[model samples]
Target chain A: MRVAFGEAILRLGEEAEDMVVLTADVAKPTQVAAFGERYPHRFLNVGISEQDMVDIAAGLALSEKIPVAVAFAPFMMRAWEQVRSTISRCNLNVKLVGTHSGLSASDEGSSHQSLEDVALARVLPNMTVIVPGDREEVKEATEAAVKSPGPVYMRIGRDEDVKFLDEPFRIGRAVVLRDGSDVAVISNGAITAEALAAAEGARVDAMVIHVPTVKPLDAQAVVSAARKTGAVVCVEEHSTIGGLGSAVSELLSSEYPVRVRRMGVNDTFGESGTYRELLEKHGLSAPHIRRRMEEAAEKRDR
Target chain B: MSSAVELADLRHATDVQKLKERIREIRRSILEMTSIRGLHLGSSLSCLEIIATLYFLKMRHSPHRPRWKDRDRFILSKGHAAPALYAVLAEAGYFPKEELRTLKSIGSRLQGHPDLRTPGVDAPSGSLGQGLSIGIGMALAARMRGSRSRVYVLAGDGECDEGQVWEAMMTAAHLRLGNLVLIIDRNGWQLDDRTEEVKRKVPLRGKLESFGWVTYSINGHDIEKIIEVLDSAEKSELPVAIIAHTKKGNGVSFLEGTNKGHKLKLSEEEYLAALKELEAKPVCE
Candidate 1:
């Protein structure tokens, strides 16, 4: 997934002369090294300092440059204050790419996993938070973030070669994959692949909505889906408290109240495990989402 | 041509006496604003001359064209001193001097911290120890665009305690950002205690030098000395760090050299006394 982002940036860099890529010494893992290797002058390694990288990105933005600062998802927390004060508060044109999101870091343990980044990034004013589910969406989302003005936080996972969507990708727009009226299975990020499988395996006619942009959330699409199905199930590889599940529940409870079941990490830190094992242990696998979807549909009938 | 005459007038306009008067006026404004809102009195007063010198004598910026591409950038990383920055910007005609009275008031552009919304403020800053990194970005951008613009970042010595500041220092040197000039207002005092008392002591000049910066130690209160050091820094081939030894609450007698003056609500009597002391002082010799 990060490789897709790197390729997209490299393509964008060829056209946008003012675009620069900055990393805090995680270029290899985030796959931004591809852009760096091609445009050596445009790429900068700030040497393991996320806060400095963030502030420097703001400075570049002020100078009329589109700067993309890439780092691990958990590391962005070190520079959250800079993101809030310098970039978001001033509405600078800087893109923050946090790769290896959720439990995608696998063996790196709880300290490396980023379960709270969405909540942190969403709270900032004028910030666009995006979590791309597949490889192609990662590329498209990177392009959209570069073209979009103001600050953008692109949360991606280390999961590679995930299934790409056939539907067109747009910022702040949700894609309805498998449309059905029985239950709405809304999910985002790397776990959307699991969500698709869950809907198919559950044997329930489910409307699967993939929300790429978390902030300025496609509320209209979510509301329409909730209205159509009357039962909603949200799955994400993030904390259940403030990820897509919370976002979906918040919108539905206010606009169109419905029976909603959120499937995600139940506010617990993830331990060291393989990505698949962690997903299964955290109840974010296909079977768990399927169970949640059935329960939500049954609750709606009751 | 008339452009030559305009340039001549600008040169003639900023004599030592004129600079002194400007500093005094800005100091007065800082006191007035702090008297009402009661914030950052000591640190703001400490860097009054440094801010005044940059605006009036050193930096190549026009209030008429605050966003001019070729203009120098100023970032106040130690944003607690925003009153001083606001005063200097107003003095340079970025906005009306009358706006200084509304400092920190609701709906005022003169926020408690410097923000880009305020004319002439290059970046939003109040959170300490982030400005150098931003300045480096601006400097790098200027280099990338083939522009000759410089970036000046003024940070507090106490703010240096933040690990990010050192990270920025190392990165700036590693990049050899000769267009970047970092001015540390070494006021020696912080809100809770003196900087040395709180942190392990290291010779600051040596630390910066070891970090690969072309370092200078200067008397921050002296406008002439600051101008001299800035002139040299402008010609350097590496990033410059000016450790400006400054006194907190510099101009006034009662509050000078005290951490308690960090932020305080001044009574009418104390405010009047401060104004008198500031007005009676001779320009730095």
Candidate 2:
């Protein structure tokens, strides 16, 4: 996902002279180092200063420059005040991409891992949040964010092992990856790969949906799927508190009432473990998601 | 260029006495804004001459062409001074002076702090310690675009306590953004206490110098001196930081030297007294 992000910006940089890249000393980890080398003049490495990086991106956006700010997912919130006050307040066209999001930083523990980035980004007024399913979608989302007007926040995991199921990327639109009518299983971010695995293994014919754009959610897609299946189950690599589940429930609880169950970290912090182990421990693995889907199917308001 | 303003028309751009009048006029406008309500008067008063010198002299801008690509950018890093900036912008004809009274009023474009919706406001800034970083970004962009424009940021001394300001200072110097200028309004007071009392902002010049800035200490109220340093700043090979020593609520007899009226709705007597004080004296003695 990080590599795709780096490649997408490099390609876009060639076509758009206004595009500038900034990183808070995580150029290699975020994989933006290649672009920095290719376009030295258009890139800035403000070491360990996320607030300055975010504000600088705002300033660059104000001057009609498209600035793409990348950093470790957890550190992006270090500049959350700047993100809210300057970038979102002015509604500037800056794209912020956070790599190593979620349990991908599993071996590094909770301090490095970000379970709340999606929640934080979702609340900003003008911010558009996307959690791509894989490398292809990360590239697509990166391109879409820069092309779209206003600020965008994307959370991508460091897992290169995730499956790439590319559906055309558009801002505020959800993609359906598998078709069924029993229950609608919605997931986003790298964890959607696990959802796909779960759908294949589950006995119930679950309709799987991948919502890359978490904010400005595709209510039409969510409501129609829920109406057809009579139940909805939301999953993410983030905490269930304010992520996909909360977003879906908030929308459906108002627009189309249904039995919605949330699947992810249940209001707890991540501990040191392997990437797969953390996802399994946090109930984001295929087995956990499959069980949730089966439970929702049996319990739906029939 | 045909759509641009005629710089030749602004004679006050060079004359010191006329510029002094310009500062006085801006103060009167800010007082008018205060009449509508609020006591952000002290910080606004503190940075007058520095702003006046830039707007009337050093800045390459046109109120008629506020978004001109080559125009110098001025950011009030100490955004509590929005009233002062709005006043000067109106006087420069960015908008009607009649709009001054609508400041912070519901639905007014003059937000309690500066926002781009207000004509001539380059960036939204009520949040402190942010202006300098924004200025650095603009400077970096200007250099990348090869535009012959400079960026200026006016920050409050007490506002320097923000770690973000120091972060910006370090980065600006490391980037060697010589095209950027930061003027710190050393007004001695913040919300309800002295900057020195609340947090020691002294040894400030030395701190900036150690951070690799081309530091200068000057009387912030001296328009001519402010102009001199700003003019010389263009030739600097590193970013410039000017410590402009000033008084809070400057030039007003009762409000001077104190942070009492940090934000206030003026009483009729206090309003008349402040207005009469400025009406009597056009410039500081």
Candidate 3:
């Protein structure tokens, strides 16, 4: 995902000379080093200071420069205040790329996992939150974020090759990977691959919708899917409480009012383990999503 | 090259007495605007001279063209000082001085903090420790464009307690942003108590120097000294930090050096007393 982001931003830098990339000493991990190596003049390494990086990005944006600040997702939490006060509040044109989101950094423990990032990013007014599913979507989302006129927070996973599809990508729009009417499996991030597999394995005839833009969500598409499927199951790699699951449920409960089941980490801290083990332990694995989809489909029949 | 020469000419052409008079008028306007109930009174008062020096003599900003691309930028990091900044902007003809009364009111551009919506405000900042980084960003952008514009950031002593400020200081030095100038309003007092009492053993100058900034210590209330140091700092080849020692609530004898003046609505007696004191003092001693 970071590789895709790096390539996309490098291309963007060539077109937009005012595009500056900032990092807090995590350039290699965030894959921003590629952009930095190519455009050293436009790259800013602000050491291990996330808060300063965010505020600096806001400043650059105010100066009419498109600045993309990259860091580990959990580390971005340190600069949450600056994000809220400076970037979002002022509605600056700054792109915040948070990598290694969710349990992708499982071995780094719960402290490194950014399960609450979606909630934090979406809560800010004038903030657009996006979680691209794969390498292709990551590149698309990075381009969309740069084009956005206001603040954007793009959450990218550390896991490589999470299954890419040659689907049309647009910000604030969801893509239907497969069409079914029994149940709607709404998911985002790298976990969308698991969602697709869950629908197939369960044979639940589910409508699989992959949402890359979590905030400013394609509400019309989600509503149409819910109305067609009659039941909804949300999947994500983040916390079930405020990530994709909660976003879909919130939209359905208020607008369409459907029976919804959320599949993700129950409100609990993550432990150090392999990415696959962490996914299964947190009920975000393919099998867990399959069972959740089956339950939603059964409930729909009853 | 012409702008630098114009700035130098303006610095000499400026009348010290007239600048002091403008400061007095601005101070009076701030009091009148905040007579009912005000926020950040002391914080605003301490940095009056610093801001006055910038808007009147130093900064290369055009009130008529507030969004001029090559103009110098000023970020009020210590946001509670919005009234002081507003006063300067209005005096500089960014807007009518009458708009000062609408400060902190609903549907008014003069928000309690510095907002970019207001004319002449380059960036919205009320959050502490964040403005320095924003200044760094602006400075970096200016350097990238090869513009002669400089970025000035005014922060409070207590605001320096935030870890982000140190991070920005390190970044500015590392980036070698010579066009950035940070003026610290070392007014001694904060909201709850004296800054020294709250954050002891952390000398502002020593900390900045250690972070590789060119540090300058000056009396903030002295308009001439503020101008002189700013001129020198602008010529330096490194990021500059001006530690301006000032009274918490300068110009008002009763409110001076008192934390109680941090935020308050002046009583009838206190208001009258403050006005009388300000009126009695000479424009420049």
Q: Assess each model's interface with DockQ, reporting 2 decimals per model.
A: 0.86, 0.78, 0.84
The deviation in Å at residue B151 for candidate 2 is: 0.5
TM-score for chain B of all predictions: 0.94, 0.93, 0.94
> What is candidate 2's lDDT per residue for A102-202, written digit by digit as tens?
88888899999898999998999999999888777788888888888999999888865566575678888998899898999998988888888899969
Candidate 1 residue runs with Cα over 4 Å from true position: B1-14
lDDT of 3 at B143: 90
| Tens-place lDDT digits, model 3, residues B151-247 | 9999998998888888888889988889999999999887778888988636768988999999999999987788889889888999999999999
What is the per-residue lDDT of model 1 for residues B1-285, given as tens digits with 9 covering 90 to 100?
Answer: 999999976775557679998787888888888678788888988998888888888789999999999999899999988988998999899999999988888999888898888999998898888999999999999998899999999999999899999999999999999999999999998778989998853599999999999999989998778988998998998999999999998877888899878988788888999998887777554
lDDT of 3 at A290: 86
Which sections of candidate 3 miss by over 4 Å?
B1-14
**Which residue pairs does candidate 3 place in steric collision?**
none
Whose DockQ is greatest here?
Answer: 1
Which stretches in model 2 have alpha-carbon errors above 4 Å? A164-166, B1-14, B282-284
- For model 3 chain A, the run of ten residues with the poorest summed lDDT: A159-168
Backbone collision count in every prediction?
Answer: 0, 4, 0
> In angstroms, how far off is A224's CA in candidate 3?
1.1
All-Cα superposition RMSD per candidate:
2.8, 3.5, 2.7
